[model samples]
Target: MLYRAPHKTAVDPDTGELFTDLLVIVVPDDSAKSALVEDPSVPFFTVPHFDGYNAVLVQESRLGEISRDELEEILIDAWAARAPKELVAEFFADQ
Candidate 1:
């Protein structure tokens, strides 16, 4: 999500209007993206942005294709990549 100061806007790409239903998930690494792509059952893809490096898009409709366990791991890694090391260690210590 774009943390642009005071106001956070979710603009629709097609109409250039604000939208509230979108979810932007930042992937942890290329390895995660590669794994997702390799799995034929799951619908995951990376885009040309950031030189097609790191970020992956998980389609809203096909979110169910990925299992709960897999999703948890992915989210954990994603947060870990961005969050502070001490916080990550404390939070995920028992996990």
Candidate 2:
């Protein structure tokens, strides 16, 4: 799922961009870890509050680092992580 930050929750260390202008996505734990490790060039970060939940904050300005297909995959995975199993199964079955 994607949501806008109500305040300046996250910031980009390099460019000083804030999360208030971006969208946060809740992903699977493995995916979150993999994104942090495998895609170090991308500025992905999280807060302590998100310790147990698998999520990451990304600056909208930095979205160029990921391709359209990658974004689509992330969105689908995020949705599946939150959606009911039956809905996810039906969604995939349609594909």
Candidate 3:
């Protein structure tokens, strides 16, 4: 595990108050998850519940570790994995 914390903080749009919330889960591709974990700078982890061992918990604090292009590629793969085949094909028609 890269790091663990009790909760994350966010601001309330209405009152400008801070509140705690659980970490968000991102279901990226297995290969992408493995690649991210292998890089020490990227903070990615697995959970025992819904994510099991295959998915990752992306910490907002460590988002700087990944490059924008790298992240976009990984996310596209993740989305394609769950998206309809026809949709994916249409999106990547030129490729």
Candidate 4:
């Protein structure tokens, strides 16, 4: 899902435009810290203004640094976190 930051939190230093290479994924609380610690190589950061919010901003352009399987797992976890229970269950059943 596209997360429009309440304010412009991401700006490209070079082009000085809103960064287009970003993907905001909702996750469980405190997941951001663990995600960063788990893979420091991946550019993951939490919005300080969003202290209670459970989401992480990932550099979409840097996703290539991770394996396809890892990306799929991240996407699945994000989807399952917000998807309706029935839909999630159905999706897993088909898998």
Across 1-95, the per-residue lDDT of candidate 4 in tens digits comes to: 45454347666657777766677877745764466535677666665654677777766777788788876877787788889999999999999
* Cα-lDDT of candidate 2: 0.72
Question: What is the lDDT for 66 in model 4?
Answer: 75
Candidate 1, residues 6-44: lDDT per residue as tens digits? Answer: 113434457775434334556677776687667788666
Model 3 clashing residue pairs (backbone) = none
Model 4 TM-score on a 0 to 1 scale: 0.70
Residue pairs with backbone atoms closer than 3 Å in model 4 (clashes)? none
Candidates in order, TM-scores: namely 0.65, 0.72, 0.58, 0.70
**Highest-scoring model, lDDT:** 2
On a 0 to 1 TM-score scale, where does candidate 2 land against the true structure? 0.72
Which regions of candidate 3 fall more than 4 Å away from where they truly are?
Answer: 1-31, 50-53
For each of the candidates, the C-alpha root-mean-square deviation to the true structure, in angstroms, is 5.7, 2.7, 8.3, 3.4
Candidate 2 has its poorest 10 consecutive residues by lDDT at 5-14
- Flag the better candidate by TM-score, 1 or 2: 2
Model 2 residue-pair collision total = 0
Judged by TM-score relative to the true structure, which candidate is superior, 2 or 4? Answer: 2
The segments of candidate 4 whose C-alpha lies over 4 angstroms from its true place after superposition are 3-8, 11-20, 36-38
Q: Report backbone clashes per prediction.
A: 0, 0, 0, 0
